[model samples]
Target: MAKVIVLNKEDFEKLSEDVSPEYPFLKDNREIMSASPGGLFRCLMVRAEGEKENMLIAQRKDTLYLGYGRDYRSFDLQGVPVEHIALEEPKAYQEHAVFYHRPSHISDLNGQNPLRPVPERQTCFQVEQVVVLSDEQFRQFQENGLKDDQIFLFDYSDKMWFDPGSFCWHCVLVKGENSRDGILVDAEGYSYARYAAFAPDCDKLRLQDVPVHYEYPARAPEQKKTRKRKEPER
Candidate 1:
């Protein structure tokens, strides 16, 4: 349930008005220009309206790719769609149409008649599920870890552990001696091991592929103050 604020050519021009030199407005042939409401991320959905087919954009951290629909579907449909780019990477818009091209219900509603105080929308890279490796399969996974481009979850249920904020371990296998290990890579591609034997601070693995439910950590309630009677009004 997300809506986009479509920016026409004339509206797109305004992006350059106060942008820093580091991030510049797009001037290329991309036809659709739109972004998540707050504009922290910009998504370009289609080519200049003449391309034979729509291109798919997927982001692996800061890197963006211009891919085809079929190729992504072939990968068990696990392709991470680049629905938008952080405003910091203005160059991302120039490379490809990174956003999905469909208008949502709210967008249609807005088209019918504009609304004040538009609703907020969220965009991010998503994976439907992560496959947990079997013992034998995990051994094989470690053997050709980096070679396998599929995403996976490691079994860390023994520790009763989960990411402090996320449900899944959400990692990629790496070349290593231990079959139980998985490496966590940050947005910038820096890698680290999440295995308890290796990095204790690292988050424990998830036994299954599931959505991470995010809830604010509980805090102690503030004690209300009571005023004593003013000593019989002094």
Candidate 2:
């Protein structure tokens, strides 16, 4: 069973520091760095099956990465080797949502804020669960067509790949009147929106013209449909 626990800034820091020895890779990881710069509260943490899987939601910085496969994907914290993970999911996570909160940079530049009562918009996606994908499992999905259910989230970080070049991971969900939203905890441990592409009457991915690529080898050819014998003979 997996447990989701919310930790305060202090507790989260202490826990992360304690665990750092066992998971040295986490020490300098961007997720942890961005989420808790100098021990600031940035995300939620998850542990599954007594250290079987440990995941966190790291915060993302502004100034998004544009273009196809801008960066590598996969968790170095996981057992998978960093190089292999990158090769498998070459594109960086790309489906990022732009937040419109009070500019922290501006606040820093100015000494004090006169707008005391003003509140910034909350830019958070309520996380429902974490989807852990391994290299072997991902390859299997490639051989077998990727089911809609298999995708927990869309290409927020674009790290989650379902297809190849046709849609690099950076594609965003199409805007629609009745689109449903889902939450995915990224490799960095941040929450991002995952729009349902298979929903009824929603050709979201197709509409976006997102390129599709498959890394695995293709299976046997599908049998073609043949027309029945002409009835004119009768």
Candidate 3:
């Protein structure tokens, strides 16, 4: 396993917009990042060990990304070494829906032996629980404006091999960071749920020539946007 590399803002910009082949950890698998409970961040590599597979850690500013693999693809992560936090808990205790982390660093919550968390590599805390909301509450949350459940929030943590079908993503979009273009990433269970995927931007990554609309999650199916005619203009 290689140590995480953190770069200053000025230094990061000097690197290539695309994946670098020079570094040992910048893999370019096109698979999008996962948002499921256990894998809240695939490229994030933030969870406890044994939780991630074939991934490397890198940081720019305050954001952490999983960008590693023996082989390179279309994109990946690269950087220099820095002291960062890595979670060592074998497991998180779950009660009902919330998952509680018992890191040894926190004496008050000590019972099981867990590794102490490092500071700017960022703190390690487990947050997994279903957010609840009544129909009215959900409506209020949407009152601000029209929104799409299938939104692509990219931040350049591209991993081409991650499959979202095994998880909770019904749809995944691998949009390029430099181009502002998009690619729809799908799997067997891709229509799994009405969810979102936060993928990284690849410099020369492939893009979808045609627009794709994942229509499974119906958008206001019962409502008609057309207005009824006024009795043929009276």
Q: For model 3, what is the error of residue 220's alpha carbon versus the real structure, in angstroms, after optimal superposition?
A: 26
Candidate number of the best TM-score? 1
- Name the best candidate (by lDDT): 2
Local distance difference test scores for all models:
0.29, 0.30, 0.28
Give the per-residue lDDT of model 2 (tens digit) for 1-234: 111343344443455444332222222233333433555544323332223333454444531111111112232334322211111112222222222222222221122346632334222222222232334543342233232223334433444332334422322232222223211222221222222121122221122223322222322235999999878854
Work out the TM-score per prediction. 0.17, 0.16, 0.16
Model 3 lDDT on a 0 to 1 scale: 0.28
Question: What RMSD, rounded to one decimal, does every model reach?
Answer: 23.5, 22.3, 20.9
Candidate 1 TM-score, C-alpha based: 0.17
Quantify how close model 2 is to the true structure by its C-alpha RMSD in Å.
22.3
lDDT of 1 at 11: 34
lDDT tens digits, residue span 1-234, model 3: 233333433333333233342232232211323323344444422122222323444443334354544432323435522333322222222111111122111121122224422222211111111122233432332232112222221211221123335422222332221223222232222221122221222222222232322222322224657987678654
Summarize candidate 1's per-residue lDDT along 1-234 as a digit string, tens digits: 011222334333343343322232222212233323333333333222222333333233334333333222233323323333223334322121111122222222122326422335412222222233444544453334323333322232222222446433323222122233332221112211222111111123322233332111312235899997676654
